[model samples]
Target: MTDTQAVQTPDNVAPVLVVDFGAQYAQLIARRVREARIYSEVIPHSATVDEIKAKNPAALILSGGPASVYAEDAPSIDPALMDLGVPVFGICYGYQCMAAALGGEVANTGGREFGRTPLRVTETDSVLLAGQPAEQPVWMSHNDAVQRAPEGFTVTASTEGAPVAAFENLERQMAGVQYHPEVIHTPHGQQVLTHFLYDIAGLEPTWTAANIAETLIDQVREQVGENGLAICGLSGGVDSAVAAALVQRAIGDRLTCVFVDHGLLRAGEREQVQNDFVAATGARLVTVDAAETFLTELKGVSDPETKRKIIGREFIRSFEGAVSEVLGDRAASGQKVDYLVQGTLYPDVVESGGGTGTANIKSHHNVGGLPEDLEFELVEPLRLLFKDEVRAVGRELGLPEEIVGRQPFPGPGLAIRIVGSVDAERLATLRKADLIAREELSSAGLDSTIWQCPVVLLADVRSVGVQGDGRTYGHPIVLRPVSSEDAMTADWTRVPYDVLEKISTRITNEVAEVNRVVLDVTSKPPGTIEWE
Candidate 1:
């Protein structure tokens, strides 16, 4: 799940609010909560207590951060959170914060406890660990430890290194754990989280994608009624495709998909969206060829953000034109198009800050790209789901594997992969290199191991190398093979040396105008998925 899904607040579902303490795992907590079939949201630690209370969350979770309680700028829990009358769960730094807020002591232990640690549950009778074994393995990554519990709190579990690993206050319905339960390294993490949600907080697990589709379809039927016509913006990508499929399922003949074939798309992308999407979903699709228009607008533009904005603007124009044509034709037949459907997922909404009305990371063409004077009401059926869940729902709806399981491609497509200005020559060069990398990776059975292997072309930079006993001056292609739980944050995957060698050798030998191949080892904090 990306940060978008991490903070998505599904309609009519009771939400669990996760207070962000600048922890990397803040989103993980939200993902876990959603995985438990409960909706959740995340807010920055700087958010005021009143702001948090206004969300009316079913429960509260404080995320762990890399901070010591004694530090000057450490994140602290809001006192108002305690009086909100909702169950609260704290992890790591959050655990320390809870202890300190309730008059406990937190000491900085010079010796750090990182990675997997055996946690022994001394009191398994507690609601959080009700049906669990006495001793279990839990993941721990912390430098500070809680020395004592606050008043009315009892130590429920502990490890050899930390004395107060787990503590609970039944009267306040509050609990804290030093170890992180959000990570997969913790064997029983999900079980403990489920216990807290169902056994302690009394929340029901009913947040399935099927239930969401059923509920949204009813709402769509009511809003659109019998005479309403809807136009869906279908990007060949999974999010948009899934959204279109769901909306079509909701309002069959009333829905029309507008797909813009920007020349920046990967090889065979346009055909897939044009032919495969219609064949799979049977939704009426309108294809707009804006390749020349996009290329014309992107001319002479080298800045990454500028290219993104230009592409977004041009895409909207093309889509609007298609919608107008479809609407005009329908109007001649006495039908009207009143709703514009977008496959805007929760990540796009949350990252764009659509949920809390805050400034988003950047303006997305689909989510934040709406015109002020637009007339159509918005219909986003897949807005409540994560990408993986969206794929599952698409499969459940009988979408083909090629359409449902396609890897994520950025909106800018190969334009972002080309280092400098995006032109036909540069895009072609990058496409060839990218295709070679993908083919080789798939041939070597490394496709599933790596989330995405972005093949980047350094158009402006050239290196001299010997090929066929002659010196050749050509640009190098960088292979960024990253492993991620969600696209929000990622780490470089450790591809086998033999596989890497094959990818390197093939890209240099087969793909012309390329001399060298390198790998990106950086993570998301340092580098985004796309290298611009």
Candidate 2:
């Protein structure tokens, strides 16, 4: 295949097309599909029939939305998609749309199901509900329901709220559920979805991280050729570490990882990368201590975007310097470093408007804030993978658990964690508070449960509080602990009260800069995971 064609086609990658019907569960469905080791992508409902067919998806999934089918301008699917011969599965609002499109009766049922309901299975021989319990609890949220199945479809399941809760057209390989199988509240939800993906659609689960790593290594080898040199920006996070390791496996000693210490990282992050990563991957690493340079540039800057731009610029400069040093005599001998490896993930790409129908949330430093006239060709091996997938790949590459299990940290590091100016004293205070939060969370056995707890320093805001002896004015630290399937959306994690108390007491007593500790109970809708 030509380079352009090869870039378009991923070998052995089976993509499941998720048509978003404006539902919150759309991303959840995508994550569940990836958890099943099947690659999936989300497209807008506005996509044409030709656009849908262009993807050549192994299966199609219609996600639930909030729109009613009877309402004007409600999201609707093309009637011709049912005849495309691809196996299709619909959930919630998707189920209503498919039913109305395929000559089924759908109307406003007086009974509106909002929570868990008992499902009665009438057909065990159906492939969609095979090996599932006859009476199962399913999470539902809908006002209208399907009253009849489409022609050639067998009504296999029902609920009190709707008579035709689930249906299957075996011959055409079509299935749908009135409730979301992507939700965890439904106990057998994943099993039902897996049945549709594997048994009904006949798709193989071959999208493991190990397989992805192998393919990326080959691609990197092919792109770099025999004698080219590449440099990876190692940020001590899972993505960068895994990306650097994979590139090292591809080009051996030709890959030199440049780690720029920008004075905004958490405690001991640099040493972790220097000792653990180097020992694990055996890749040549160059550590540049440019903390003073970065802090000097960011002396009085308090705006998050401006800080990000300065950090990105300084990072590129540091990376260029490292490249020059690594290329010492080789550049004079006509050899050049032409590749810059990054660990940019799918969420980063999607959040940055790199995906179809996705909104631009914020600009990630590595992905969107880079210098336009940079010299190196970008090599992002994990660009299409998610955070959990990156962790799996890191483990598959035999990286230490410390590196593989490390939580996601921003490219701008602790500078963004502080809600105000970026400085040495503020950095130190926030770092101490953050370390205490990390320690207590880990001690309370909540490390893996909570994604990443960002102890934010509200340097611009201070409150009055009575300490042990007298009144004190100090910065308040905001503890943002979130739980998420992916970083795209998150819900606040309810940490135990005891654990919270300990974190609060320790931060106030140990680090004197802060007088109060507040928990951020906001979810991702109104508030992002990060404070700034």
Q: Which has the greatest lDDT?
A: 2
lDDT of 1 by residue, 1-532 (tens): 2344334455566688888777776767888998898877777877777877666788888889888878998768777678778898989988888888878989976646899888888885687877777888898988888888888888999887788899887777788799999988998888878877877788899877677667666766776777788888788888788878777777787788888888887777887789888988888788888889999988888877677778766766776677667775676777667787777776666656665433456555566555555667777776656677787778877889988777788777787788888889988888888877778788888767887888899888999988999999998999899887566568888988888898789888987789899988998856777786
Question: What is candidate 2's lDDT per residue for 305-414, written digit by digit as tens?
Answer: 77877887888888888877888778898888999998888777666655445565666777666787788888888877778888888889898888888778988899
lDDT of each: 0.79, 0.86
Regions more than 4 Å wrong, model 2? 1-9, 296-306, 443-449, 489-491, 523-526
Q: What ranges in model 1 sit over 4 Å off?
A: 1-8, 46-55, 66-75, 107-120, 129-138, 141-143, 159-161, 219-227, 332-338, 350-365, 368-377, 445-448, 494-499
TM-score of 2: 0.91
Model 2 Cα shift for residue 495 (angstroms): 3.7
